[model samples]
Target chain A: MLTKRIIPCLDIKDNRVVKGIKFLGLRDAGDPVEVARIYEEQLADELVFLDITASYENRKTLVNLVEEIAQNIFMPFTVGGGIRDSNDIRELLNAGADKVSINTQAVKCPDLITESSRKFGSQCIVVAIDAKKENDGWQVYINGGRTPVDLNAVEWAKKANELGAGEILLTSMDYDGTKDGYDLELTKNVVEAVSIPVIASGGAGKLEHFYDCFSQTGASACLAASLFHYQEYTIKQVKDFLKGKGVSVRQ
Target chain B: MIAIIDYGMGNIHSVQKALEHFGAKTVVTNNPKDIETSDKAILPGVGAFDDAMSELKKQKLIAALNKHIRQKKTFLGICLGMQLLLQNSEEANKSDGLGILEGEVRRFLDRKGFAVPHMGWNQLKIKNKNCPLLKDTPDNSYVYFCHSYYPQPKDKNIIAAVTDYGVDFTSILWQDNIYGVQFHPEKSQQTGLKILENFVNLC
Candidate 1:
């Protein structure tokens, strides 16, 4: 059975793990490696490190940091941000990063997805589509939720899957940092539309929210940052709750 | 000395780093001279079977590998690297393998809605009760898995461990000095690193 995964996302800027409210107003979390170690000890199913600025930066420190994590922690984790070409993807994976996520670069040159997937294999490629609701329709956002993309959310997911993206990380910008819950409608909409695994991100406030998102939306996994960062809930506690709710967590 | 064969397949650096992490003197090499002189050889591959074979043949590393394997040297294969040790793969078409181990690779047909590439952590069912590779690893412990095809060994003596995805499938195979893991030991965290350490300390 496909176990429902819980991943703690570390947003790296310059090299440190930081989080912001609604994609703005940054706050320091802690050492990236220490935080990662905590999550691993808590039995986190996986970890996601996004160089929120990987695409914009001249050079990325996330790859080095990810290598540090890979040296100690052994569970599979995906590194997103600034994966522009096959070489970048190959570098990250070769560095012990299990998977690499692509956003703006993938949209601008869709060939990145197909080429990376073809060269390295699809399971190693992830297409993370950042979206927000606008006038009853989801609009895709790129460049760390700073740029608006022309492709439709569902359509882009289909294209990515067709291009050999094994997983889709759909994030709701509107609900992000709100602590209300996920944009169920949007998450469900995209999950139903794609055969590939969908990870619902943004606006995960409480344990029930995870249950609600997984039960109602049928997402393969739920990803959160703020909650885990602030110690709002330990992953084990949340997984225990979800397991009680009959969700298959990697126990 | 561990020579990680770099055939332009997947990430060889990480594999080397992991080996070096365990204090193994490792060299990432494609040259036959380097491999022949190394104490052990590790084949790390990612991508289609046919292309990996083509790359090995194109670079003439297969003959070097055959010579080394015939000398009873330690060889470790990872992911597609592991699958390539078998007879052939059903990924795209029938492709020849290194044949260092007795097995054939086949796509994992869908079972209970399991995706094609069985990604993420899954438990391993060890067959050889005294398998040294699984020393500290727990029974049914969740090891990272990312692949579509599993090795079907012709000889049960080589079966080190099995993992259940659809039905029971081969997760790890060890024959004489040749060892192959479908899961990345370098990526499996503690358990994975332990396997690598054991391989390094192999007598």
Candidate 2:
């Protein structure tokens, strides 16, 4: 059966696994390889690493850091941030990434999505749409949610899917750090807009949020950062809770 | 010493790195003489089955490998490397395999809500307790796998470990001196590395 996945996203900056991952027993948590090893031991369903430094460094993608993380991680993972074109996607995938996540680049050159899928297959392409509440409606945010783009969330998801995006990663900035709960309304809307599997990201406080998102939003997976970074919730706990809710998970 | 057969299919660099981490002298070779002279051979591959086998046949090392097995030179195949050691694969349709093991590769059919390509970590259930390669592996331990078509063995004795994916399927195989892991040990965290280390330390 197609089980609901529990993913722990790692945000990389300056070739390190962001400062937020300072969990206990993981003194060198900022190291991508070390943090990845911990997550692998806990049996994370998959992992997603976003490189936030390359944009400032004017570098293409973090190939060196990718090589480091890929050494420790065994399951499928998606790498995103500063992925400009097919060449960048090719390099990351060649370095052992399962899929490439496109946000800013897809908005800049929508054709890159089509080109990437043609070269590396659609299953290797994922479109991550970071969104925030705008006047009672969700608006898309680009450039790591720093720049707000005047695009409707549902419309953006529909367009990205039409362009050959295999999956949609819908993240709500409103609840991102709050840990209130997933934006179920936004998740369900995007899920309805596209035929591809949608992974709901951001705003996961407790195990119930994960269970709620899977049931209400119909999202194939849920990705959390702070929750996992603090060791507040383990992937096994989330999976077991989802299983109790009658949602299928890997045993 | 481990000689990894590199015939344009595997990302031999990572495999080479992993084996060396265990302090094993690993050699990446496409030369038939290397396999003939090496103490043991490792077949590591990624990408499609037909492409990998074409490289093997193109290099004309298939006969050399058969002789190596007959001589009991220990062999290990990883991921698509293991799949290529089977009879045939349905991927790319009508592709001929090395026929080292009796089986055909086929896709995972869904009864309902099943994902294609079964790509993630899955727990392995040990079937044959006497298999030496499975030493120290915990029961129901998870291993990484990323393939659409899995090997279907004609002889049940060849089965080593099986994983349940909608339905139960063979996850590991051992026939005489030949050992194959469908999951990527080089990628599979500690449990996987321990298995690879066990293979390296085997007599």
Cα lDDT tens digits, model 1, A1-251, are 45788988988877777773222122324567667777778888789988865644534466677777776675778888777778788778876787888888889999888888877788888899999887868999988899997778988998898888888999999999998998899988887777677889999998899999988998878999989877788899899999999987777
- Going through the candidates in the order shown, the clash numbers are 1, 0
Candidate 1: regions farther than 4 A off: A20-30, A55-57, A60-63, A134-137, B93-95, B110-112
**Candidate 2 versus the native: TM-score?**
0.79
For A61-120, candidate 2 gives per-residue lDDT tens digits of 487777666655655678888888887887787676777899987887889988876555
Q: Lowest lDDT 10-mer window, candidate 1 chain A?
A: A20-29
User: Would you give me the overall lDDT of model 1?
Assistant: 0.82
List DockQ, one per candidate, in order.
Answer: 0.46, 0.19
Highest DockQ against the true fold, candidate: 1
Give the CAPRI rating of model 2. Answer: incorrect
Q: Residue B6 deviation, candidate 2, in Å?
A: 3.9
Q: How does model 1 score on DockQ?
A: 0.46
